[model samples]
Target: MSSRDDTDDLRRPFRHTGSWYKMGSRQSSVMDSSVQSLREGSVSVLFCVLIVALGPIQFGFTFSIFGSLSNVGAMVGALTSGQLSEFMGRKGSLMIAAIPNILGWLAISFANDSSFLFMGRLLEGFGVGIISYVVPVYIAEIAPQNMRGGLGSVNQLSITIGIMLVYLLGLFVNWETLAVLGALPCIILIPGLFFIPESPRWLAKMGMTEEFETSLQVLRGFDMDIVVEANEIKRSVASTSKRVTVRLADLKRKRYWFPLMVGIGLLMLQQLSGINGVLFYSSIIFQSAGISSSNVATFGLGAIQVIATGIATWLVDRSGRRLLLIISSSSMTVSLILVAVAFYLKGNVPEDSHLYSDLGIISVVGLVTMVIGFSLGLGPIPWVIMSEILPINIKGLAGSVATLANWLCSFLITMTANLLLTWSSGGTFTVYAVVSAFTVAFAAIWVPETKGRTLEEIQSSFR
Candidate 1:
């Protein structure tokens, strides 16, 4: 196991870029705290609905129209947003992202052909990717330090919920209906604009003291020691400036190279885990394994993903980063091997020959295990670790690089999975199996323990 040593909190002191009190004599506690009422507000509920409903419009019907474009767009968005949010600040970037989301739903619902659907999906994917990148940064910045992990996780949680909700809706609703539903979030986002504060850290750095304080109070309420936290924020931000912004020169520096490497590794392992093949095309994989039923296997795979992700949410914090990755990676490796073996066995048996096609049960077992293993380890860890460790100055750049790697890998894997399945039924899955085993070794040796460590501390570990 990698070293799991306790280290001092690595939060650098904050220094607001502009600390002038410019936002209406500092919003009163009542006004400032209003943003915190997201749970009670109709707009907030609508916001959740908007996010969750995107599944249908952006992701309905598996591999066909919505889901494919959505995934690609999101990858592009995540990579782009990583850079955009850093420079534009988290709030403005997120607000801008909402447009395409709304547009996508409209186009998909109204369009007549696959071309319109594809265009809409492309737009939706771009917006979704932005949300995935920006939301975590926003949430992490808003929450009090102790609550950051729990709250930041909601970003990913919303996505999982969104995906699952789309799957459930597909049980009955048509894609057209789902496309209309996806628009709900865009409309709701307009109202949410009135609330959900600009990230305090972002505002503060931009030199908006009053806005920063107001954003903080809105999210934190009166219970937290605002004065103390504000001061701490100042110190942290100040320390960051001393390190200088990331430049090409910084890239050449030996001190920062390890994190860059880790970033690449994180995204590489994420896609290499054989997750996309199972998620986007589990029904197909099931059919290949002699389980010809689409409806049953798709539902089963989705259920497995949900269950495994639920388990991962619980275990990730407790098990810590290193152990969870090792275990999850190892389990995924074994399960992939099983899947490949099963596929090979089926490939050898002539379809015309009467054989027990009931291996659906066995295929389900193998796939479920692999999915569970993925949920527990590489699925969540890559993003979490990357987000947790990357330094603030270059956080967006590094995240973009890593996420770009993920998208490329996903595209390659998905494309290859299809080509290989067509070219050699037994071979592509074998490659995926090898990839999974290699991921186990990567997690075991290269990845480090990041549990409970502050972002700066984790960054230092790579050094």
Candidate 2:
């Protein structure tokens, strides 16, 4: 690594200095943040559309299909592509992942049965697996520290927005219409392929000095002042030892094992909070409670989720990471408790139809509280934390690992919810309430504040 002539770069901001952006399997000029985030934010919206819609589209008709397996599909994609991404660069890997959903759309559009729907969901999961890691790491690598949380969280916000879009659209259009809407995002990928730059981190790691320079320029919006930023990238890249290898056996090492457990535990706890059950089963819960108007429940839930998640996004950077987890988790735990009590009351009501004794009021309040608790914490924080702690090198693999746990936990939660309803309706609600209590303990003991930390700093903490 050469010491950059600071004076020269300061004077000639736009001149070519043969910096490192030039070395890669592909070539490109440096780009700016606005362009980068726009592309990333758009992709994030597409992912949201697919994820929220997949459950309703695939499992709405069938009880046994299980929505979380779609999450598992993402896990599988992450596992397969994790280390592969370190070699390929984030942009290339993400573009590759985007294609599966396109294929998934083809399958979904013509689907006639569970098999086809399942396969479509499976493919969509695979696409998420590939891209989820790439996104946060991309934002982390490119975004200035002051703006990291806001920018990193655009993915989560888009997802909430996407969920809002689908639920609203579902009312006006049929399942097929929503399914088609899921595929429309692929169109963005075509332009993304030509415009988006590779991870500058990856470029620097390989020491492709010339290519790095051009990539840096474009990444910085070709600003002559970008040299200082480019140099920061250079030092960050240079600081890490270049030789890297990953083996399954590496999982046993304390450094890897600890953070991996932390990451996955956060994922598991996120689902255990009962957030997803509320999201997927909102209308069902409402109807069972004799809470009139399924559309009202669904739309209300969507709107609150969007609003609460928006608040979360706004404060995620400022309010601090650990605080949100405590607040959100505590709220969810209480909400679930209210929900269980409501179910208990509903069960004992003279006809399971009793309109009064204040049971109905309690049940409705419980339902809304569940949505609020989830939107604020369980729904968004896990993704943000996962993105924060996992660096580019291990991102795909780590994300896959954590997300797999997330999906499996989700499947268990949903299945258990169904089975509990059969065995004892009140018991199912109580179980999650119990889990929520345990998660609070876990968050307090284990999860750290990640709000203001950079990807490197978070990684360093784990060590």
Candidate 3:
């Protein structure tokens, strides 16, 4: 084949411009093929990164052991998620995760004392920790490349929706009823697993060739020709199988470390920006800000997050990852600053004065805007980028490190938010605002635009 033909083949899957290119020479084709195969390892490594990349809200508070214990459980679960998925397969791991969630919720529902409540909360967090990683990875593997971003964003959108549901339902339901409600989703998921196919790449990696092909066929639709995609997955699995065992020393290399750094940095910074603090303690924050209906305001905040995240889902593929991140981070910085200023003014103004109520209004608007900013890019894009960028050989270890970092940051932020608010609300938001400002710079300088790029193309850019 002509050089042009070979080049076209390399570029076919990713039509957008990026850092890597291929020459038509046979030598280059061979090298490219090797890299392509490695990139294809994305199928197996996808869940690995997702596990590390998607540390989400195990909402923390001081109200009970529930707050800190859940995050502790999630940290533990995140640590184990990669191995569990590897040993049990994606479907098996999810089933394992669901059991804890169901039992935790039930335990919470019927709790007679703090011990049961704590146990249930911890179990619930453990289940969420595993599910957070596995579900996104599952979605990333199964989704068509063209639809990946939109579908990936759905993961965050669902989290926002769940938060909203909880806030909205808290008004009408007793805590016991809400706990029972929490169990229902997992209960429903248990049986639904039977209907879905396992990750084809995983099957391929495990040397279950026929099963891999069948799963791919089912996922892509029975009528579709999966021959090309199937071969790609097989090559990926084959190349990955031959790679040397990854070690801590391997991280010294730029190609190995850069993507991991990006993944960990984005996730850690995401939590440090105090999104969870705002979420877990929004009721108290609103009340202190002089809102008449703190519960209603909290619910509204959740609703806004859902709406913003939905918009993000629609825009992720269209606008690209880097752009959304920059926009999102910038908006968050400004919104946080606005909040800090409002809170500062609240201290200086008299409660009965017009300025105090105006400051409250400003605080509300700023808080809402910050949540919107987060849901748009900071919330979902980190997972998508991590799934796309991490090198396959180091995926598991790197993923675990990243997941641990995220959950750790989440624990620290959520655990301390109430104290910080009491210490000085203005000071708390000021810290978050500064972190958010740094995130804007980080997104602009470090985060790559993964939109419309194949995993191989993305990884190659790091080289």
Candidate 4:
């Protein structure tokens, strides 16, 4: 093995003057030329690294912006998502949404420079923003009252599954290949949209009576009696439509305000609980928890979330929304408190001591428990509740507001989490625990159970 002196000697750049005085003329010339070549080579390498480090755009802060552009796009898309869905039918909106997603992925895949990559991310974000709102509303409107909770829960389950799939694929594939794959689902969706039934409620609201009935019949089966459900949808839509067009002031009404508050509050709190920050920095968290294989632990966390969300899907309809939310939030509070205490204790213990290792394990356990608790309720139910409770008249505009609040909170949390963690891991977890504890009370007192209730029935409860 080389000592520090030897390593330093090896690294020292070649120089001509001193050695050349004793060397043959030809050897001296050759040495001097080689040294010049090495100097130029080093400079060239640094220039290339600078270019790469600045990202394909090579502008100041562009690299950071590149990573966050998608979120910005998503926020814009969310702002308009309700309007787009209302303008076009659910199926139509989804088809339109898929176009940008496909194009975005293609742009990303073929990008030689940063502009295409940035544009692609923006487009993808926009498409996702629209889909996020429409998909859940469509599911809630189409599903049978008995099965609505389970089906609505699937929206979140599918999200967790997609996230897990991306993580797994990312392990082996290049980013370009992954981008191409990212577009595939959207591409397939374009054609599939043609065959699926449009949301019956949407059709009803549009006054496409024949199409609404047809769509409902298709979803419920021609053999099933559709009269009861059809009438209920018409009555709900008709009554809401007759009121003056909802303005910001109209939301002050209890019917409008209560459900909207609950929906937006839950969605915002979901983000405030710092789920994204935790997941985003899971690797760092695991390392701090004394896990040797942080990557595996991260993947394990994703898998656990997927499994827990799946269980939530199965339990949602049977157990009811409010109960699950209460349980989920309460469990999350406890888990986060455990994590906070562990982090606090770890700081006081010597790193080499047994107590340090035990504290680390406690942190790991607390984090896992928190993830499970989140997956069971906070992750999925808020969207379900949002879709269920909002009136059809204001759903597009109001739902957009709710969705926007969620994305905004998500951005804030993602941006600040690192700073908070840097300040104090224990303190960061303590803040999250407090938020989760508040969510428990919010869900219990304010959030309604929409399980086993028709859309009209659920909306009526808000009135």
Q: Which candidate comes out best when scored by lDDT?
A: 4
**How well does each candidate superpose onto the true structure, as a TM-score?**
0.80, 0.80, 0.86, 0.84
**Candidate that beats the other on TM-score, 3 or 4, i.e. the better one:** 3
In candidate 2, stretches whose alpha carbon ends up further than 4 angstroms from where it belongs are 1-69, 112-114, 216-221, 224-233, 243-254, 351-357, 391-393
Candidate number of the best TM-score? 3
The sequence of per-residue lDDT tens digits that candidate 1 reaches over residues 298-399 is: 776666666676676666666776788788878877777776666667656666655536444555677788887877767766766666666666777877
Model 1 lDDT, full chain set: 0.63
Please give the CA lDDT of all the candidate structures. 0.63, 0.64, 0.76, 0.77
Ranking of all candidate structures by their lDDT, best first: 4, 3, 2, 1
Please state the error at residue 309 of candidate 1 in Å: 1.4
lDDT of 3 by residue, 141-246 (tens): 6766766787787778767867888888888988888888877767767776766678776776677766776676556544344556665655555566676787
lDDT of 3: 0.76
The positional error of residue 350 in candidate 3, measured at the CA in angstroms, is 1.2
Task: Give the per-residue lDDT digits (tens) of candidate 2, residues 225-335.
Answer: 355556655555554444265677877876577667777888888777666666667677777766678867777777887798778878778887677777887787787
The number of clashing residue pairs in model 4 is 0
Q: Cα lDDT of model 4 overall? A: 0.77
